[model samples]
Target: MIYSGTYTAIKADVPEFFMRKFIKLERIRANRESIQKKLNKKWLTCGIFTCVAAIAMIGSYRYISGIVKVSSNVNGKELPIYCVQTDEKKVALSFDAAWGNDDTQRILDILKEHNVHVTFFMTGGWVESYPDDVKAIYEAGHDLGNHSQNHKNMSQLSDEEKTQELMSVHEKVKELTGVKMQLFRPPYGDYDNAVVLNARENGYYPIQWDVDSLDWKDYGTDSILNTVLNHKALGNGSIILCHNGAKYTADALDALLDGLKEKGYQVVPISQLIYKENYHMDVTGRQIPDAK
Candidate 1:
């Protein structure tokens, strides 16, 4: 009987020992499962971080590529570059129409005939006087820029007056052609610090010609053509200034275009030539090219 009691006691101890072992095993499995879940969460977080970092890097690269700074000299003043640069052989044909609308159709015809594009800077008075000509200019796929209201010297005017001159022309042009003027060439190529600031405030780019035909001086066609031909070699990103009122200018237009073509220069608008920064004109009147 003593022996039978000892055997029962040993059997009870065996069952208790097994239950304790089973509990320990379960605890280990629970701990392992928790560790695995934590590892997965950490990996997911790393992936998300990597994706975000990649996107940020791509955005920064694009932002950097889209902007470029240029510096060039203008009339012996150092100016920052505010325009983009293109490798394309292009030249912008800009006409200052300060007086007379009779030759408007002729100008348009010449452009259309050559399938060439040009920019016309029209004064407010001229636009009001010749609405039909303005319409034809717009319809012909030509760009319209501002040349002030009354063809006054912008440099001589105060800041407020400059603003008025620009805004008045802007509004008038918009009303007449349903197009906004993005560029302004000061009347008589005259401008100052106030003019530049006022133009910037009003969101207009002040454009000046790199080459002057001097046709307004009644230079004969050959003389005007020679001036352009001589300065034409001045390189890319040149703005050639000519007037519509000059008979010689009209006569030289076709020849000048032909010469520009022969030289393999593509004529584009001034808006396409400048960068986005506020540039100060250099002593030589060229916008400095901004370092990328």
Candidate 2:
């Protein structure tokens, strides 16, 4: 009953029909995927461009104005109180003590003679090494700040490590001197956002220096004296950095104090010079009070 052309043709037509439809469906799917890839790439490029533009705008804003002062945190980055923004002709002299006690007594003697109170940033190692000197510094009424436990670069420390570094020294100093330190100076002046944030969490104000006495180079008395005295940044609310182990620091101490006094600069401890609350640090590390 099969018709020669009719039945044979219908049988062939059924398979051919499905094959064409299958090929067409495959083509549509391929085209859809191609479009999706192009769209994804375009979106990615746009997103990157937007981010770069935003960063550029923020950088421009910061440049035109000094660093944008926020609360304790600034755009997630924290800043240290380097110097105060005060019109009073006052400055803070700080000595970082990490090693060697030879100059400790001599420096203390000179400071006593001048009747000048300075801050001494001491580490836990320094405290353990010279407990007597630690007590002496506290007894002499100098600002004792925590300078970490091992003097490692705090920027590289983890949050827990930073807390330990800060608190270990904090406890050590408190136990030895009965004084709870509220100030912190990162070792070698090394700090990052995390370091400052950790310091805040531990209730310590991070400190930095505006004027540096290059006495650490053992640059002799004249060189040290000139650098400290003639620094262009020498002004009201300046913080000067010195090291207790510096070879010429003790030698330069007398001349340095006399020069500052002659210039009508009232040198005081960091505690007396810094504002504890409602302060913001400028790009130059000048801490300006919110009320000001």
Candidate 3:
């Protein structure tokens, strides 16, 4: 405006040219202001849209996560809980320790370094053999579960034998670490309907893994890693089975944790991963909450 006013004062020297320049500058100024106003309004609209979308996303996540906390039932049958039906990217790592202690301490050290706590289902025999390992596992804040006494298939055992298998290990763990084991993973992952019923009757929650790392097979570390991370069942609330005695597991531990974390999974214990009561299992072995 100041430039325009100065030009206007010198308009008498070149009237037509100065008038034309004045009009052109005024038009340019008006257009710039108009475009800036439109841009400001557009930015305001985008801000509102972003806030609304974020709120909607949070609501959806909560609604999905609420399903796992709610418990459901299926027709009086004692079903083993395999995985939880949740939208959270959380997963549980369960180790069945029924054999050698060669890799136990190494696995524990790796877990400690990563700050990831996993569940260890120890047999009575493993506890008897590696009493200090049991104490160390408990002291390190990992979940202790009953993996039976002799590592025999629960399906082949009578009800009394099953009870003994569970109780013997539970008692030994309690004696060793003062931690009572309530989660049971049947030896060899072998369990029948009766086994499930017996476990529940004995106040233990039978757990099964959806993602099997096949660490028990003693395959290479790469194979175990590929098996788990590539498994189709790898998803939210997935129970992953590993072994404390696997040759490759200790070597694979850091990479396995990194892969799971990179894929946005929070490794938790089975005790924290599963529902204690009021839940039902779907035919696919996924645990769902009872519909309200």
Candidate 4:
């Protein structure tokens, strides 16, 4: 026979001892399920919070350490040596030679007259067209720097292409002058982390200028002189940019050298101005010597 009744009727019919045990067991089960649910919810929330916190910490680290995206394919920051950190009154003058060589001899003569040794960053085409000048620069105690093969924007090239751009010119300069170039300057001043890192991997110190003469603008000789001499960035470890093909650069060279000398600045080639080892670059691209 089956018994059917309301919950209250069933409860009334049950023995008191068994009923008390059933009620206690039901309460314990409910409490256990409720506690388990609360624990699960709390664990889920903590897991999500921990994941979010980890992500935030990584982003903050990247931001504070000057880590940047150079391109879609490359990450992290690698800056070229724009200038050096020093207390000595010294600076480097660098000239990029990508085109015409009409004024190169004249510029060399002026540098010789002043007993100043400067760096000449030359393209492969320029080196090919003016091999004699390349030899002359090497013989005259000037720095021969690689300015790439086709003078393309380094930041736009692939890893292999960038290496070719650097090494092709490197081999050419080496074969022509028997000098292995160790300095590289990107064309049009365009570079990224890849451009700089590739140069370093290939045993070249990537160079950039802090002080720009604006000589490429063809403003005039006086304008070039004034722009360079009065540049606020002109300091003890400044690197000044000029071009061998600029219209007014050769004209302004003598006065620029004289003015720099008058200002108690010793001008030298890039090789002499930079630290060869144990150095690090700051966020602004200034190379600092690691404290011993």
Per-model C-alpha RMSD? 9.4, 13.0, 15.5, 8.3
**Candidate 4 local lDDT, 1-292, one digit each (tens):** 1122333565877887877676677678878999999999999999999999999999898765443222112235777888999999999999999999999999999999999999999999999999999999999999999999999999999999999999999999999888889999999989987898899889999899999999999999999999999999999899999999999999999999999999999999999999887677777788887656
Candidate with top lDDT is: 4
- Residue 259 displacement (Å), model 1: 0.6
On residues 105-176, what C-alpha lDDT tens digit does candidate 2 reach at each position? 999999999999999999899999999999999899899999999999998878999999999999999898
lDDT-superior candidate, 1 or 4: 4
Let me know the TM-score candidate 3 reaches against the reference structure. Answer: 0.74
Give the Å shift of residue 52 in candidate 2. 36
Off by over 4 Å in 4: 1-75
Give the per-residue lDDT digits (tens) of candidate 3, residues 47-122: 9999999999999997765654442334544568889998889999988898889989888998998899989998
TM-score comparison, 1 vs 4, better candidate: 4
TM-score of each: 0.69, 0.75, 0.74, 0.75
What ranking of all candidate models by TM-score puts the best one first?
2, 4, 3, 1
lDDT string for model 1 (17-134, tens) is 7755755676788789999999999999999999999999999986754432222334444232223344667667788988976667887788888898888999999899888888
The lDDT of each candidate is 0.75, 0.89, 0.86, 0.90
True-structure Cα RMSD, model 2: 13.0
lDDT of 4: 0.90
lDDT of 2: 0.89
lDDT of 4 at 203: 92
